[model samples]
Target: MTPAARTHRTAVLALHYQNDVLHAQGCIRVGLAEDDPARERVIAAAGQLIAGARQLDLPLIHIRIAFRADYADLIQNCQIFRQTAQLGAVKDGTWGAAFFSGLEPIEDREHEFVLRHHRTSGFIGTPLELLLRKLGTRHLIVAGVATHSVVEMTARHAADLGYEVTIAADACAAARAEVHKASLASMSLIAEVGSVASALASEKDSR
Candidate 1:
């Protein structure tokens, strides 16, 4: 991390399942696809450490999945909903259905909220933006798996909500690094993208 930024409030959201879950975790993983394994591992580690820091009294906001029984909306809006549900990709009331383990569940934590969504954006079909506003969060640092999907979606919503968003580029792993990069480039115009260390350093400097 550098020493160019101050410590700002951050919210970390885990994108998919991981080693904390069973082998059937989730389809989103690194190296196993067109993504870079090394980048994935690094981002995962950064997220883990950030979670730990948050747990240790550092300012951070955490978000996770809270599945609901109603997949009807998804069924109507998205065609893949039923198909992925059949594959048990994101089954309700299951461990794999929750957030990755490295991320501490915000369940009982302060300024924490769980958002259940049938789509990619956590803010979509959910009151994520409201919760963030209540938490007095002006800055959001996003880091998670599947850069092309969840990470991108959330960042876009954040921008629309007028939040200063920053994506931990290296802290995100995806099935396609190129696509992830493309998303990052687009997001940078709307938000900002940086490595975890660089971001942390920038945050520390801001403080």
Candidate 2:
């Protein structure tokens, strides 16, 4: 293990690693872990990040987006989600709603938990804050699909809530490279945006 993976107080927040978004047969996998070069980079980096976090003994929180079978909790106020409503995207208890096969937490890991959120920001409707507090998280390392959406929103919210945020650039993917890059640039103002290696360095360097 690297020195940084020895004694870090960081909590790794992995978002939207669901099969529906990452797998080849997933409902929206075209621009994610499938054919998109940008997203492919994110997936590769996320694999490394996950390995590093495990070695460092950091708390791992997997956040997924799931809605009720009846779609009662889905917000139809915007067109972006209207498609979800129509297609029944990520309905709970389905294979598509489960975490991607390779990314599920090991059963014996004590500090890891899977959570379901109904919105873009993981903290808005979830126990993420409480878990972080319990883990005494001083820095949050965020990685997930859809950099322009969930990843960016969560990082901003975490920073505003007084936690130092670190965006693992290569661990976040978007439908388009431009959108991904733009979101990262925008979030750099509020959080430290870098590759998985650089983000891990911060964890090692933190007091």
Candidate 3:
């Protein structure tokens, strides 16, 4: 990690790694093949980051998008929200809303938190910012699926909330390469875009 990260309270924010967003049969996996290398790469990179956070004793926060079975909490103000409601995706209590294989929170882990939201940004209608403040988290290391949406939105919001955000670039994916690249470019303006390894590196290693 960078010197700034070593001096500040930091946390890992893993967003939208649910089956409904990354699994083969997921409604949101449009334009991406089940065996897409990009998807696999993101899963692996994110897994590594999570493991690293656990070893470093950093808080691990898993954020997912889920709605009531009746879609009562879902707002259809955007195309993605409307599609989610139409496809009946990410309903609480369903397998699709579960975290992707090997990425789920460890049961009973004190530092691991799982939060559910109904919107694109994890902070929207959620206790994410409050939780971060309680944890004394000034620096955020983020990794997630759909780089162009949840990841981008959350990073931007975090920056605006006065948190130093670092996005694990390789740990995030989108339906298309161009979209992912564009989103990353946009986020670079407000956040540090780096690889998982760099984001998780210790200060000694950096030296």
Top candidate by lDDT? 3
lDDT of 2 by residue, 109-185 (tens): 88778888888899988988887877777789998988888898899999999998889988888877788889999
lDDT of 1 by residue, 1-207 (tens): 876533336655544433322122353334343343564465466565475446544445444433444544445345435555554455567655655555545567554455666677767777777666555677777866567767788888888888888888776765566877888888888777887766666666765
Off-target runs (Cα >4 Å) in candidate 1 are: 1-10, 17-36, 39-43, 52-59, 65-73, 79-83
RMSD to native for every prediction? 6.3, 4.6, 4.5
For residue 106, what is the lDDT in candidate 3?
Answer: 86
Query: Better model by lDDT, 2 or 3?
Result: 3
* Colliding residue pairs in candidate 2: none
Error of 3 at 50 (Å): 1.0
What candidate 2 gets wrong by more than 4 Å, as runs, is 1-8, 30-33, 37-39, 205-207
In order of appearance, the predictions have TM-scores of 0.75, 0.89, 0.92
Query: By how many angstroms RMSD does model 1 differ from the true structure?
Result: 6.3
- CA lDDT of every candidate: 0.60, 0.82, 0.85
Worst 10 residues of 1 by lDDT: 16-25
